[model samples]
Structure formats: structure tokens, C-alpha cells
Target: MEKRVVVTGIGAVSPVGNDVDAMWESVRAGKHGIAQITRFDLEGQKVTLAAEVKDFDFGDRRAAKRLDIADQYALVAAREAMADSGIVSGENVDPNRFGVYGGTGIGGLATLESEVSKCVKKNTPARASALLVPMMMPNAIAGNISMEFKAKGASFGIVSACAAGTHNIGEAYRNIKHGYNDVVIAGGAESVLAPISFSGFANMTAMNPTTDPDRASIPFDVDRNGFILGEGAGWLILEELEHAKARGAEILAEVVGYGATSDAYHITAPDPEGEGASRALEMAIEDAGIAPSDVDYINAHGTGTPYNDAFETIAIKKVFGDDTKVPVSSTKSMTGHLLGAAGGLEAVICVKALIEGFIPPTAGLQKQDPELDLDYVPIQGREADLKYVLSNSLGFGGHNAALIMKKYED
Candidate 1:
């Protein structure tokens, strides 16, 4: 028989707030985190806004100076999660049975850019620091997290763009269900709020042009333009049912099922038909052995982009049918787009919604897009007795991932 997996702890370092409670409160209150970019000079950039982690002091200046922002975010969030789970040493849980699975879209881009600038100014490759390569690598966050926690089993990173965080949690769930590990620290982190990163996205016309934080990421609204880039990290502690019970851990929510698919049509754009996304939803529902109607709420991958919002609506309709009145919302309206960390943060929101009995709303949604009509819990959150919720994350590389989380029960 396959084992079951449950979320015991969650940690977040997000634009809206530094910790999970503060972040969730901001999300629930419909507060927007996007603002004018201040990390670097934005003189010639068309897009000058982002949702950045504000007033974050990692406490240890030495570690802060040595590590990249993404790595620091991951480590901080992981430390919080580890503390919340109360699994510090090998007394209750074996070190070999613990694992780490992290994800990121563009890891340490700021570090790479800084090192390159130094090399160019000094006119020599030797000017770059020896740690430059490791710092810039996408897997460095996971490597550092594993070493920090002493997780000796199945330590690695997932790099599926925006779907990365969901993929990490999904894969970690599978690992525990199959008895490969008893516990896993899984999530995604990203901090690419640099001039080069902004310029690239702006050049592609992928980011929102509006400077107003509240209106910038207006998903499901007819006036929606595009997503606002954001930075942060989200981590969760997932453990086997028996192991958690043996230790008397507080179960937050159960990860019931996961589904991943590829559009195989475009590199950056989703298939207009949303066939792949629909299939992923179907697969996740099937995997959970639950009917479509059973899912009470949906945390949409609503990027506020024209193509993404419409295509995601089509996919949701295809799976749950047009008549389904499932309340859907995009937390990105407040948190902006956390890239690889989007899925992880959204998953934490889903679990929180289950536990708190309330659904967060899409912050800036005013006039709903007529063509895409659904109960998109607009403008404000509402109290709901949610039993099961699904969170979707669609990435740039035709990657589509869905995770089903249900209220934990004995």
C-alpha cells in the first residue's frame, strides 16, 4: 500500500510579508506588494515595477554577505520550516530519511551579473570570485539547504520555470508516498530583481506596463495587461503519515495528488486551446480519486497576462465544466509573480485556506472579462468551509502543474 503525505510546516519570505502568517494576512486583506523597482537604476527600462521582498534582514551579516539572495531566501525559509516542524536532530527522525527538493527559475542572476561586470571592468577572467560558478548555478539553493539541514537522502533541485515550486512539492509527495524518504523539505526560491532580468522581460513584453501596484497584476479582469515580476521563497515540510503521527506532529494539510504536463506547442506561450492544462487538472483529480465537483476552490495560475488568463479559464472550464461554480482567485494580484516560487507560495496559501476556512480574492479584479466568466472571488476574500483545493502553476516552457490539497483527517 502507498503511504500518505501531509504538510506539517510552512515558511515564506515574500513581497507581501517576511513570514507565512504576515504574508497570508496580507493576501487575505487584498494588499498589493508590487511597487516601483528600487534594486537598481531603471533609467532606460520600459518596465520599472516589481514585487520585491522589502525590509528583509537575514540576521547573520556574514552569511548574508557570502550567499546569493536566492540562496539566502531559501535558507531562511527552510530554517523557519525546520523549526516549525520540530525535527532538528536524528532523535525522532533519521538523518538519512530526510531529503531536500528545491526549485528556481533563474537562480542568482544578480550574482552572475555582478561578477561579469567585475571581470569586464578589470579586463580579466581571473577577477571573478571562485564561488561565482556555484553561486550562480540553479541548484545551489538546494545544495546549500541540504548541507544546512543534513538531509542525506534524495537532495536535488527542480528547474521548471514558474512551475518549479509545485513540481518540487509534487515530486516530494511521491517520494514519501513510495517510502523513499520519511520527510522532505520542498519548495522554490527566486530573487532576480536586477536590471538585466527586468530588461529581458520588458524586451519580450511579458511584464505589465502599469506603474500602479494594485492595478498592475489584475488577473481575470478585461483590462489586465501582464504579470509583474516578484521575488521570494516558500518552503514546506512534508512527512509520511505514520512518521508524523509517531512524533505527534501537527498536520496542516494533506497533499492528495499532483499532475504535470507540457503543452508541446510553444516555448513561451501556452497552447491557446489549453489542452495540456486541462489534461493536467484531470490527471490530478483522477489521482486524488475525487470528482471534479468535489474541489471547492481553485488557486489559479492567473498571471494577469492576456494569453495566460484566457487560456487558464478555458482549461478550468474544460475540466470542471462551464456550470461549475468553484470559487477561483489569483493571489498574484497581491504577491506579484514569484516565478519558480509562485507554486510554492500558492500551495502554502491553499493549505492556509483549508485550515483557516477562508478563500483569498484576486486583489485588483474589478470588471470581470465577459468571455471568461467564473466565480473569481473578486476584490475580497470570503469565509468558506473548504474541504479540498487545487492550485495551478503554468510556466514559460510549456510546463503545467497542478496540486490537490485536502483538509487532513485521521
Candidate 2:
């Protein structure tokens, strides 16, 4: 028998704000977080704007120093989520049955860059730090989170480029739904706001080179060129439905469906036909056993890149019909592109929209591309009775993932 999974708690550390409430408030107001680079000097960098987390403090100096920046973000968000869920290991839930499924696009890149620079500049390969391997490993975030929370059931990180976060949540949902785990902490974190990261993205023309925060990440707009790099973390506590009810947990939403597919065509560019993405959306809708019309809202994976935005439109149309009336918007316009954390942050937005009966707009989306026609809810959010919402995430390396979240009703 397949069990049901529900999201009982959520947390976020984003550019718009440090915590979930602050981030959601800024999102609802359609305010952006992108700005000029501040983590490092941009004297000769082509890309000047990034969605960097501001005023972040992990509150524990010793612990913060031990973990990489990515791990720190994950730990902070996980702490909030664990507190919000009120689930104590060995008390309400078994520590052995608690799992941690985290994801990251480029984990601990800051540590990697730092260590590599030390070795290269000092003209000696032995100049690297002794703790470099553990700090910079891609799975370190998951390992750190699992150890912190004593989640011994399943602890691992999924690396699917930008789709990593959504994949983590999806896998966690499955882990609980199949009776493998009672509770799971699923999310993603990223903080590679270093100069090398920026240079690579800028050289590839993957990032918007603009300095204006408002216009840097304008999704679905005709003038949108590319995405701005954003760094932060978002987390959710997914529990077995029965376990949540037994503990009197406050359920925010239900994880009804998950769909994952690969483009198999390009490393960075999406398939022009959007066939793979379309199939993923179709699979998710079918998995939920719901009609396309049942979804009240869609949090699009509109990355603001010309190919991504246009092709995503086609994928949505493929699943929801050409004239579908479902309200669609890209919160990335405000949050920038969180890479692996994008799906996590967007999933948080979907849950909040479902709870508050509101739809956040695509900030700075003043004009929509005439070719792509849909109710984008541009510039300002509006109230809506949202029941079911879909969050889409399409990453580099042909990764495509979709999650269907239904508002909880007992």
C-alpha cells in the first residue's frame, strides 16, 4: 500500500529575506532581491548583479566556521523547519526512520575555489587545507543535515543541476509514500557567489550582465536575456500523512504528484519542441489523477532566458491546452535563480500561495512577449482561492522535474 506524504513545515533563507516569512512578504509584494555584487569586488567582471543573501547570521560562530557556506544555509533552514514541525527524534518519530534528502547544483563551490586558489597561488599542490575534501564534497550538505537532525534512515544529496532541489523533494515524498520512512527533511541550498562562478556564467552568457536589480531577472518579458545568479536555501519537512496526524502536526499542504524527465537533447539549452518538458507536466498531472483545469495556479520555471521562457510556455500549453486559464507566474523574477535551490524556494512559494489564497506576480514583468500568451499576473500579486498548484523546475543537463502540491483539507 502506498502511503500519503504531506508537508508539515517549511523554511527559507533567500535573497529577498532571511527567513520564510520575510521572503514570502517580499515575494507577495513583487519586490526583487538582485543587486550589484558585494561578496567580492567586481572591478573587471562582466556580470555585476546577483541575488545574494543579505544580513545572514547562522548564530553559531564555531559551527558556522566548520561547515561550508552551502552547508550553513542548509543547516539554518533545516533548524527552522525542524522547529516548525515539532518532531523530535526518538520521541514522536524514530531517529532511524527520519531521512534527509537534500540537493545542490554546485555544492561548496566557495570552499573549492578558495582551496584551489591557495594551492595555485602558493605554487604548491600541498597548500590546500586539510578539511577541504569534507567541506567541498557535493554530498556534504546532506551529510551535515542528517547528522545535525539525527536522520539515519536515508541521507544523501541529489545533484541534478538546477532541478536538484525539486528532485530531492520528489524523492523524499517517495521515500515516505512507500512506507520506507516516517519523516524526511527535503530541500536544497547554494552559495557560490564567488568571482570564478560569476566569470564562468558571464563568459557563457548564462547570466544577465545588467546592474539593475529590478530588470536583471525579469521573466517572461520580451526583453529578458538571461537569469541572474542567486544564492540561498529552502527546506520542507515532509512526513507520512498518518505520522503527521498522530503527532497533531500542522499540515501545510499535501505532496500529490511528482514527474521527472530528461531532455536528452542539449546540455544547457532546452529542447526547442519542449517535448520532454511537456511529457513531464503531463506525467505529473496524470500522477495526481487530476485534470489540467483542476490546477488553480502554476509556478513556472521561467528562467527569463530566451529559450527557457519560450519553450516553457510551449510545455505549459501542451499540458493545459492552448487557452488554459490557469494563472502562471515566475517568482524567480523576485528571488533570482537559486540554481539547485530554485525549486526549493519555488515550492515554498506554492505552499504559501495555497495557504494564503494569493498569487504572487512576476516582478518586473512589465511587458509580456506577444508570442507567449498567458495570464502571468505581472507586477502585482492578487488574491485567489488556490487549491492545487504546480511548481516546475528545468535544469541544465536536460533535467526536468515537476511537483504537484494540493492544499490540505483534513
Candidate 1: where is the Cα deviation over 4 Å?
A: none
Query: In model 2, where do residues sit more than 4 Å from their true spots?
Result: none
Q: Quantify all predictions' global Cα lDDT against the true fold.
A: 0.93, 0.91
In angstroms, give how far residue 377 of model 2 lies from its true place.
Answer: 0.9
Alpha-carbon RMSD to native, per candidate: 0.9, 0.9
- List, residue by residue over 307-383, the lDDT tens digit for candidate 1: 99999999999999988899999999999999999998899899999999999999989999999899999999999
Tens-digit lDDT string for candidate 2 (209-264): 87777788988999898999898999999999999999899999999989999999
TM-score of 2: 0.99
Enumerate residue pairs that collide in model 2.
none
